[model samples]
Target: MRYSAGHKLETRERLLQSSALSAKRSGFSTVGVDGLMKAIGLSGAAFYSHFSSKDALFSAIVERELGQSLERLSGQGNEDRERLERCLKQYLSMAHVEQPESGCALPTLGAEIARSDVQVREQAEIWICRLQESWAQILQSESLAWAILSQCVGALVVARMLATPDVQRTVLKSSHEEIARQLAVQRAE
Candidate 1:
């Protein structure tokens, strides 16, 4: 059987999107190549045609997820304090806490990324630093940017760890409040 010219690219994209969501919802290391491919309706052997290896797919997922995050968080060339605040509110929300697969990858995948090879870690670092750079410009302090970034991701992770919704909401609220306070202080300075 023959396929269209775009068939390969479309199949690859499907694999990437499906695999990324799976990795975010469950740990990347927990899923093998066969599992990843199976999620997208392909056999395990077909995985190599799209990606050289599982690690390659991981790198691609990191790049795609972080790139989307950077776009949503940073906006385009005109991010300001208000925009950054809105981004934070969304990032630290209960919806984000409950929906790991559809949201940012950091909270879910940070540990796995840290344990990945140098190349994968480097891919993540590039996007992470760019995100920080965007926030730093608006916040006017590199340290503050890092702090808020850490706080946001940490808050999500902590919120997800709790069994009760009330405690989870408290964790999100506290982080949001503290981050707002810190931003207010920075603005005053």
Candidate 2:
């Protein structure tokens, strides 16, 4: 049976969304086209109909995931100092550590993106700059914005790497406290 245009579009979005989360859970390199298609209950042949190649899917997922991150960072989440603090609290929390699939893509897929094709890397760069710009709006310094972002992403990456929850929590706590102190100093000056 032939699917309508809207149905095809909906299927494509489902594939993209599922693949994005799967890639977050397992690096893009580790997820095969067949497995990805199977996860969405589509035959492998249908994948090529929607995407030229696996790399194309990876690129699309990077764009979609990072765009979401940009929205979270730039949107009302960072509206005021209180909101920003609340956002950061949740950002570095244990819950975020436990659920990388539904969380930010940077810490989960940054390394994979670094090794991906130019198109994928470019998508990564674009969203990163968008997020940086958003943070710069609040911090008023591009350098500080990058530093804060780096610390938060690094904290998450390390938290995911270690075997123990205690160490992970410590990483998150230390980074949170350090970032807060740095922000306070920035405000004073």
Candidate 3:
């Protein structure tokens, strides 16, 4: 049976979403087309029909994930300071650090992207820029935005690499508190 164009698009999107999560949980390099297809209940043959190559799918996934994040950030408008704080708290929580599949793709895939092909690297760079821009608008300063972004991402990476859950939680809480304190100070001055 032949699927309609809309059906095909939906299937492709499902594949990309599943692949994005799988790639985050298991390094992107290790997530083959066959495994991704199996996870989505599709035949491996249908993979190429959706994307020209794995790299193409990776790029698309990056776009989708970043777009979702941007939309989430935009919803805060300008007055939702408490909402922003909660978002950061959730981002650096132990739950996020321990769950790679549902966590932000940046810390999970950053190392692999560094070694990946140009297309993937370019897409990653675009996502990073979008994230930074969104944060800059929220914090009202480019420097503070970069600092918060760096601290959040770096804290997650270190927390994940640590041996104990307590250590991870401590690092995350400390980083979150420090960023929040500094941002408050900046607003005061």
Per-candidate Cα RMSD to the true structure, in Å, reads 1.2, 1.4, 1.7
The TM-scores, one per candidate, come to 0.96, 0.96, 0.91
Instruction: Judge candidate 2 at residue 8 and give its lDDT.
Output: 89
Off by over 4 Å in 2: 75-78
Show where candidate 3 strays beyond 4 Å: none
| TM-score, candidate number 1 | 0.96
Q: Model 1, stretches more than 4 Å misplaced?
A: 75-79
> lDDT of each model, Cα atoms only?
0.92, 0.88, 0.83
- lDDT tens per residue, model 2, 112-182: 89999887898798889988887887788889889989999999999999999999999999999999998
Ranking by lDDT: 1, 2, 3
Across residues 34-137, which tens digit of lDDT does each residue of candidate 1 receive? 88888888899989988898999999999999999998998455647889899899999998988899999999999999999999999999999999998888
Model 1 clash pairs? none
Best by lDDT: 1
* Order of models, best TM-score first: 1, 2, 3
CA lDDT for candidate 3:
0.83
